[model samples]
Target: MEFETKYITPDIKLALFEGKLFKTEVMFEHHMLVWFISGETKIIQADATHIFGAGDIFLIPRNQLATIINYPRDGKPHKTVAMHLTKERLKEFYTRHTAVGKLQPLQKVYRFSKHPLLESCLASLIPYFDLGDDLPPDLAAIKIEEAISILRSIDKAMDGLLADFEEPGKIDLTDFMERHYMFNMTLDRFGYLTGRSLATFRRDFKKTFNTTPQKWLTEKRLELAHYQIAEKKRKPTDVYFEVGFENLSHFSYAFKSHFGYPPNALFKDRD
Candidate 1:
């Protein structure tokens, strides 16, 4: 069974998901704070895999795809709390504060070390989970501020992560697209990430790739899917969504159209 609780305010979201085993992949839209209340989990980013258990807390930055594996630990259901901080809120806070300009690039994920204040802040929210969607937005904002305050005291790095709210500067389009093609987001999102407007992104993308963004994405995703299914022995159903196809049927149709055979033929030929 999949049980998820989503509590949202204008700038912050408190969420919970309970599932025994599942693989989740998505491009994060906001800065995320995650706490595991029960279960063992694996977080995969590119070639890296991070494993954690109950009582673990970590942070992830926005604009990247991640694969999360939730599995039961010690005969208990997997449960976690996730908090998302919107860019608009971060920018508002950053503009009012001047001290954050002298910070460095922050790490993508920061595992919380032992901190009494952080623990206390998390503990205070335990009772609110019972209130569910009825929890007051102002109270939720206050709690989020409290958590950020605790983070600020621990390291100057927090300031950089939270306050560096400007849009991404112009980056190499080819490099950015290659690394981020798996994310199933709109052209505008891609444009923003590459520091271009929608028109400029399309113009630049065509110049660099000699193709439209949508076409390039479809081809790239299909190529990767083919490699996984043919070389890595992965099931099309398992990797279709990860590679950015909307559903299994659509993925199969496209796969057959591209390769002149269904994906299952790979395994059939191997045998």
Candidate 2:
């Protein structure tokens, strides 16, 4: 990572980086609140894509699977202030505060752009970023609490997302796997996220899909990559990581092994 961070704490950071465009896929364990200072980001989830630029403020909820692509805009670096809202902190806060709802809503992300209270809360932290360890321990907690309060007070939609503190329940195995196959997570991690043990996930997956998890994942990823290359005219370099393979070489080899030809061959045939 090529960036300079002015940290008030490990959880809150100023993401300052220049020159390079980068992409990453992740499943966040904590909700992330961000205020962009410059550049742009395109965040892709299972069903939607969002483009945000400087002065944009947004919250990505915990356990959301996303692919984030960051770019420098108009000669400036991709810079932002980000704070992680951890479950432990939220749990403590909600113990005293009255929660709005017990059921979770289906909203993908929350945008609180330029809201006065949120702006004030986030901007107040910039000065402390320079202080480093010299900053008091309780300050981070205070600011986080302030941010949470602002979120809950302003957005009617915030309650169900921020207040609910339950682990994921078991969903339709086939549907969950289909939607999330492109993410590269270990079997245990995948199982845990779907409210299953490693053994049960395997057992249920076999019953539902009639194939092992590894085999099913590889085939689904390759098929998606093939569609991108052959049907969508995308390059192998561009298609590899988005389709879940870690590297172009591995994706190419797998593409050849599975399809009886390399990905580039499909591109050439299409062209």
Candidate 3:
């Protein structure tokens, strides 16, 4: 199964996938906090069965083996907004963040909140669906940012529900990375912003996702590059630079290995 990343901002990502459910295995380099807007399915993970319905929220940590059965039929669609985040992303809001850090190996699933405040905030995100067109990048950015704010608010509220509260503010890692992924980002800097130690960040990150920070960052860049080549009609040369891949040969090799085809082949017309 293939999952595409869309509308990535500082702290969130809006992803969409329309595909038949078959027995499958999935993994993520970053944490996935999913709002299942529509669809009914049963997810089997770690020998446990989870029945999910519309309006239910599910959290899947970085690396896990799970199978989703799209009930009713395979042709039926399952739509969801998966907010891909990292512990480092949330730590930016406070000089002394502790909620996620305290709960090492946090709970992987939380039922939808009955709290009216959270319910209403989640409801507001539905309107952003109208702004999905690729045109109007400015308007799209504004709407997407608004949606991210709402998600952050919900995350705070949910964290409270779990009784793990932290500072109140938006953690805008998306803006930071847009400006700074080119520079060498150190664990010390990242930990200082999130109130974690470099050692703690590395340990928790590896425990939660089963991958190192460097590997995840590389995969994210490649994912962005793949999106540009296939969806944005971007040239390989332009995409390499745009995604901060300085070496074209490395980019091409990685692209071919990951996608099983040359970059140009992704844009070629098929019979």
Candidate 4:
């Protein structure tokens, strides 16, 4: 049995998942503050992977790519409370201060392990879960403001990470795509994160990769799938989702279409 539930307001919520495992690739639109209440999480980034167990607090900066694996541990479901620092709220908080922050290269996710203030701030929200989606706007805003204050008090960098409101600037398309192609998001979403409009993303993608994004993605995903299935001796089922195919059947269909044979054919001694 696998199910996930969220008791959420517009900016905050409790997430509960009960299953063997749950995986997702995300590029958040808002800077997210999260505290793990139970279970464990593996956050996979381009350069590093992080593990968060119960009582860990962390922040995922806006517009970063990550694949998160949630595991149910110690016979308990995976549970967490997540708060999003929205642009509107930040603007309100930092009103009359007009400053653009200079970014250091490639700022990664920030971790605050078991900080008492952050833990207290989030734990108060568990009871609010009974309100479910109807968590009140006024109360939610107050709680969010308190969290912002707590963050500012703890780290000077929180101001720059959360309050510097700027759209993503243009980045090197080739490198970005290579590292992030396995994430299954729409073309526009990919374009946004790489700081391009849809039209410009297509134009730049074509010039840099020398092929359409769709074709390139399909080929790259299939190639990775082929390497895993044939050389690494992994099953087709296990290889499929990791390479960005949504499900087994579609991966199988596309695999056969690309190689002129089914993926399972690469394996010997099939009973």
Which candidate has the highest lDDT of all? 2
Residues forming the 10-long window of minimal summed lDDT in candidate 4: 97-106
Q: Which stretches of candidate 1 lie over 4 Å from their true place?
A: 1-14, 18-29, 39-53, 65-78, 86-101, 104-107, 113-117, 131-138, 269-271
Every model's TM-score: 0.78, 0.91, 0.41, 0.83
lDDT of 3 at 218: 69
The global Cα lDDT (0 to 1) of model 1 is 0.75
What number of clashing residue pairs does each candidate have, in the order they appear?
Answer: 0, 0, 1, 0
- On residues 82-172, what C-alpha lDDT tens digit does candidate 1 reach at each position? 7676777666655666545455546367788435777677666767766767888688667777777777787666887777656578899
Task: Put down candidate 3 lDDT per residue, 14-123, tens digits, no spaces.
Answer: 44456644233344445565666565667654335688766676666553334455533334456666555454543443333333323333435555533354345445
Candidate 3: regions farther than 4 A off: 1-20, 71-76, 96-101, 113-116, 129-271
Model 2 over residues 1-271: C-alpha lDDT tens digits? 5777778877899888885777888788889999988999988777787998888899999888888889999898999999999999998998898887665845497888778788888888888887866888899999999999988888776878987778888878888888889887789878987889999999999999898999999999999998988888888898787778888899889999999998888755453
Residue pairs whose backbone atoms clash in candidate 2: none
Model 3 worst lDDT window (10 residues)? 161-170
Query: Model 1: clashing residue pairs?
Result: none
Q: Which candidate model has the greater lDDT, 1 or 4?
A: 4
Top-TM-score candidate index: 2
